[model samples]
Target: MISEFRSFIAKGNVVDLAVGIIIGGAFTGIVNSLVNDVVMPFVGVIVGGIDFSNYFLPLTSAVTADTLEAARAQGAVFAYGKFITVIINFLILAWIIFLMVKGVNRIRAMEEKKPAEASPAPPPADVQLLTEIRDLLKTRA
Candidate 1:
């Protein structure tokens, strides 16, 4: 059973999946940083410096706090700005993955289109030598 488990774990597909998961986790952090630190700042500058993180709707009259965190502490609040940021992050990540898959598919297609190596030609025939050898063998027999 342990040997079977080891074999399953050692399979190429399993290892590849594990590697992909690890890389995806790291990539998520990079995308999040790109959205929050880089993209959002530029967007804010373009839109007159309005911070989207603070944009929310108060569900209750008691939720009058300016920040989402403060509003949440006071009462129920709908945090749409955070949702918007998350949507942007998802779009960026999806686009990157799509481009990567497209590139891989293109490379695979190019490889498939390449012509196979030609097989070597057979050696030239020697009819006279073959006949002489057959005659000599017949005489011996």
Candidate 2:
């Protein structure tokens, strides 16, 4: 059982999965930063400087809350902005991953498309015939 477990852990797929997970985590951070720091700011500027993360409504008409927290405190069913934020982040992450994978596949396809270099021709036909004749003569002797 221990040997089986060790073998499983040592498998190429396992190592690949581990590496992928680590890289994915790092990529997640990058995507998050891109969404929060770069994309969201631009989106806000284009949309009249309104913060998407702050756009929400208070469910309770009597209890008007200025912020999401205030709305939540007043028991309002708010959009929470976090949901949309996460959606945008996920879209961005997926797009980046798709592009990277596409680029890698393109490179792999190019490599595969290249014809293999031809090896040097074998010994001349006359040489082969002579060798065969010499072998036959020796066998007869």
Candidate 3:
């Protein structure tokens, strides 16, 4: 059972999955930073200086706090702005992945389109003659 487990863990797919998970975690952080730091700021500026993450509806009358965090601290709050931001992040990430896949597919298509290397041209006439002479000598022997 232990050997079976070891073999399973050592499979190519398992290793690939592990690598993918690690890379995906890192990519998520980068995408989050891109959304939070870069994209959101620009979006805010374009739509007037309003922080989207701070926008939320208070579900409880007790929650009068303006910011989403403070509102959540006070009582139940519907944080739709955060949801919107997350949706944007997902869209961006999806588009990027789609583009990467497209590029890879295009490269693969190009490679497929390329003709296989032609067989080496027939040996030069003199080389062919030498080969015939050698074969004749072998036959004679």
Candidate 4:
């Protein structure tokens, strides 16, 4: 059973999956940073400098707070602004993945479009025998 487990871990697919998971985690962090640090700032500027992260509605009158964090601390709050930011992040990440898949597909299409190299046809058996006989005769001469 241990040997089976070892073999399973040793398989190329498992290794590839592990590598992909690690890369995906790293890529997620990059995407999150791009959304939060870079993109959101520009978006905020365009949308009258209203910070989306702070946008929230307190569920209860007692939970009156200006910011999402403060509202959450007070009571349950509907954090729609944070949701919007997350939605935007998802959209950007999805768009990037779509572009990457499209590029790979385009490359695959180009490869498929290339004409295959045609191999030269072999001479007929009679012609081959005649050629061999001629070579023998030439050697004798």
Candidate 5:
């Protein structure tokens, strides 16, 4: 059972999955930063400085705390703006993944279409004769 577990862990699929999970986690951080630090700010400026992260509907009178975190701390609040930002992040990530998958598929298709290695041509007559001579000498020895 231990050997089987080791074999499973050593498999290419497991290694690839681990690597993918690590990379995906890192990618999430990058996407979050892109949305929160760059895109959202730019969008806010473009849309007359209306910050989406701060935009939320108060479900209760006590939820008037200006920011999502504060509103959540106070009372129930509909944090739709944060949801919108998350949706945008997901779209961007999905689009990038789609593009990457498409490129990989295209490369795979091209490779599949390429001609296979041609069989090596037979050695020249003189080389073949030399090889035969060498083999004969070895047999005689």
Candidate 6:
């Protein structure tokens, strides 16, 4: 049973899945940074310099702060703008992956649809001579 489990774990599909998961986790961090550090700042400037990370309403009795952490410490239950930002990051990553997969599929489809490009065959000598004879015969006729 242990050997069977080891074989299952060591199979190509399992290894590919593991690698994909590791790469996906790393890609998530990159996308998160891009969204938070790059895209959001430009968006904030466009939207009148508003920071979405602190865009939360205070409802707890200790309403003495304007930050999400302070609101959370005061037992607030508002949806975090950071969480929404992360969700958008995930969506954009998924879209990029989808577009890449679509392009690969299109290339594969075109490859399949095309006829195999074979090298042109050399003309046989007998056929070439016959062509000359035919041309001469036509001129004589």
Per-model TM-score on C-alpha atoms: 0.76, 0.78, 0.81, 0.76, 0.75, 0.71
Ten consecutive residues with minimal summed lDDT in candidate 4? Answer: 61-70
Comparison by TM-score, 3 against 6, better one: 3
Query: Which ranges of candidate 1 are over 4 A from the true structure?
Result: 117-119, 125-141
Q: What digit string (tens of lDDT, one per residue) describes model 5 on residues 101-139? A: 999999999999999999999999999999999999999
Model 3: lDDT of residue 31: 96
Q: Write the per-residue lDDT of candidate 1 for residues 54-78, one digit (tens) a residue.
A: 9999998988798999999999888
**Clashing residue pair totals per candidate (backbone < 3 A):** 0, 0, 0, 0, 0, 0
Best by lDDT: 3
Clashing pairs in 3: none
* Candidates 2 and 4 compared by lDDT, better number: 4
TM-score of 4: 0.76
Per-model lDDT: 0.93, 0.87, 0.96, 0.94, 0.92, 0.84
Winner on lDDT (1 vs 3): 3
Q: What is the lDDT of residue 102 in candidate 4?
A: 100
Ranking by TM-score: 3, 2, 1, 4, 5, 6
Model 1, position 97, has a per-residue lDDT of 94
Give candidate 5 regions above 4 Å deviation. 113-118, 122-141
TM-score of 5: 0.75
